[model samples]
Target: MTPFVAVVFVLLVLCSSTLVAHGGDAEAGAYMLIATSSMKPKASCSGHKVAPSNEASLNSTWAPLHLVSGPCSPAYSRGTDSSSTDDDVTSIAKMLDADQHRVAYIQKRLAGGDTSNGVAGASWDGQTTDVGTYLPASNVGVGAVSHVRPISSLNKMIGTTAAPDGTSAVRQTVIIDSGSDVPWVQCQPCPLLVCHPQRDPLFDPATSTTYSAVPCSSAACARLGPYRRGCSANVQCQFGFTYTDGATATGTYSSDDLTLGPYDVVRGFLFGCAHADRGSTFSFDVSGTLALGGGAQSFVQQTATQYGRVFSYCIPPSPSSLGFITLGVPPQRAALVPTFVSTPLLSSSSMPPTFYRVLLRAIIVAGRPLPVPPTVFSASSVIASTIVISRLPPTAYQALRAAFRSAMTMYRTAPPVSILDTCYDFTGVRSITLPSIALVFDGGATVNLDAAGILLQGCLAFAPTATDRMPGFIGNVQQRTLEVVYDVPGKAIRFRSAAC
Candidate 1:
């Protein structure tokens, strides 16, 4: 439907087709040119020469074809843009053109054609020449010029098919290195100088009948021999270092010389000897005790010695094959180790052995019930004149409560009730009741008035959330306070000084 979608679909189809056509068997084919020697000269006028029955005995083989200067022939002559004509030459002088090579005529054989001049005499245009017909003049002893002619008898021969037994009856022959005198065979495989599984003993320098093992350290051993180390009286150890005993004074010795001692003891005593006497000392002090335990303990001790005292504990395994190993200061160090079965001991009362302190403090203040304490009020409002209701003093809160009571009384016995009856009937009603309302006073009412001032001062001081309002309510109160303090003309200041 879209250009991008159509392009993607076409790409998918092309890739799928390509992948199917070039399956796993895909490989590049090796191309080799088969050489031949005996072929007809321009008989069909194609680039390759066709083999004649009697002279087609040459076998096809892998060989480099020779390029030589040969006579050219006029196989096709253009009469017009679309058609061509040909003529054949039989005389030697006539065959040799200005090109300095004999030209041979080629006639395309047709069934039931005239035999005399050979079907519309076509000249052999200088092109591919037959090897047999173009043999060197010096090779022929006859001094007279060789007569050049087309062999027409080849027309009687029929094409042969190869036998099923990996043999072909029809073989092609090509002239190879014709310009050089060196004779070369065609089908023989090329000589390979490198060593292989089929051939061994590439070179033999000796004529003796006796056999002897060659010493690896000898000069002659350099020829196809194993590597060797220089002669030394010390025995080579597992780590490639030389080792000897320290007891012997003259004889060359090694760890094997001291039967009762460990290799390290022998090494220590022998290594302390002079260089020349190192290999001759066979006995060593095997009486000293060897420290075998605590490689890990030694590491820890060294660390503590370099760094300072460190406390550590080994934790028992957990039930889920997990536990912890701890080190350093008491509560500061911990390591998780998963073993088979154990429980991790976590103490809630114990404090971490770090420098930081954790303190818990409680502040108490009295106020009317709300949410958050007034101390949580924004610091920005503290510098402003706005009276945040949530941050009102206790006296201001009482004044606002009194105002609420008076407003509710006025609403119950107000003239608006009579006005409402004039518009709608409710004369049978004996009792008068109004919906309950909540009062919210502004900061100006509390900041200037006695009760309001006390409420605001109480709010400004810290009070518990059990008796105070949220910080958001405090901001709302500040806004209301601003409205009351700076009233615009014709704008009635609505204050929650009464209850509904």
Candidate 2:
């Protein structure tokens, strides 16, 4: 038997003292508190695979959520697969590092800063990190993994180099991002080297019968914000967008037919048709970005009339599993009403308007609130998809680390991995016991994180922010396996556990 099995009973006794789960109402002034005593502990640290949802039968309002490198992803390539545990850790770290640049850029914009190019907050450059190396672009057949399929279209002027097969129709994969606004794709004229290499064929506007560039005087051009590059020679609206990792896309602002599902199609969808793109972090499988931010140009705002400005997504716990992003609330929303917890969607003048902000009241460890002041988290935080690790203010993170370390005295400590300092070695252990951690929000709603959310490669899945004054980030890792609902019109966000 393993050493862990022999001491299983002893560990259970230790866990009884080390862990506490209780249920209680938020105190009148408590900033944040940990998990309730009534909460239940998970069986193990190894994440469980979630079953695929029947999105087709559910309706046209649903879209599948897959990792860019996951096996189920349309962009998946055997040579560049990031499904392994070690690769996941490396990829996540790079993403987290890239997110810091995003935070810095947002801060600069809030301070009324403009880039050297005479555009307000147009530059997404900062102390960027290397996202990683990718293999040469290769073809991958397109198909729907769940309710959603690749956005396919007929090509008009396909280049021989880009479309070696000379096919009339091509499908492209997009990265669903909630961090920023403006949807865009590399267009046909983006010759090799000018645009970053991509697995799918570049979007050929000449082939798209419904394609039309917006005039410089159009309202769409005005809504481009800092992204508006200016007018082309023929008065076509031009746009330039840069990511925190220094990747950039510059092209004409155009409208096209965007297919959400077989039955749902949005005509005259505004998007970018980039003739040039540059970045090392741009995944070859991803042809472009689908922005879900709160800005006027975001997909959510554009489709508000049809979907009530409401959307929800369930992120799979593991890469092999499946998750769904839905435009409208499902019928199950009524049944899961009892399980739903909601908090007000906050707005702050000191933060980027395009981001989703929420108020965080306190943090609890082992059913007890951490020793941190509420004022530390007074600044509203953004719930981000690209960011992999939850970032807390320095004071808050230190307190959390200290409290967690105190509660986990029974376990052996492991060396730190990159930014994740609080780690434990669970080698030879058959079962694991963890102290319950809970996050308390402004409306008395508490979210007890899943085990997978709490640990990334056996280390605490959180880090300190660049500065205590900067806003915090609630990242994708903590959002795993939960249905996160964004009710834009209602000005509220809801959470339901075990959604996948």
TM-scores of all predicted structures: 0.11, 0.77
TM-score of 2: 0.77
Instruction: Please give the lDDT score at residue 245 for candidate 2.
Output: 61
Per-residue lDDT for 278-348 in model 2, tens only? 76645444566667778888877887776777887776654444455666664545665888899999876
- lDDT score for residue 271 of model 2: 82
Give lDDT tens digits, candidate 1, residues 1-500. Answer: 11100000000000000000011110111111111111112222121121212221111100111111112111112121111111112221122221111001111111122222221111121122321122110000000111212223211211112211212221211111101111101111112221111111111112111112233343422321111222243332101111111111111111101001000001101101011212211111110111111111111222233212231211110001111111122211112111111111111223211101111111111222233233433211111111112323333334434433332352222121110111112133332221111222222222111111111111121111222221111212122111111111111122211000
Please name the candidate that would achieve the greatest lDDT relative to the true structure.
2
Candidate 1 residue runs with Cα over 4 Å from true position: 1-395, 413-465, 468-473, 477-500
Cα-lDDT of candidate 1: 0.16
Error of 2 at 385 (Å): 1.3
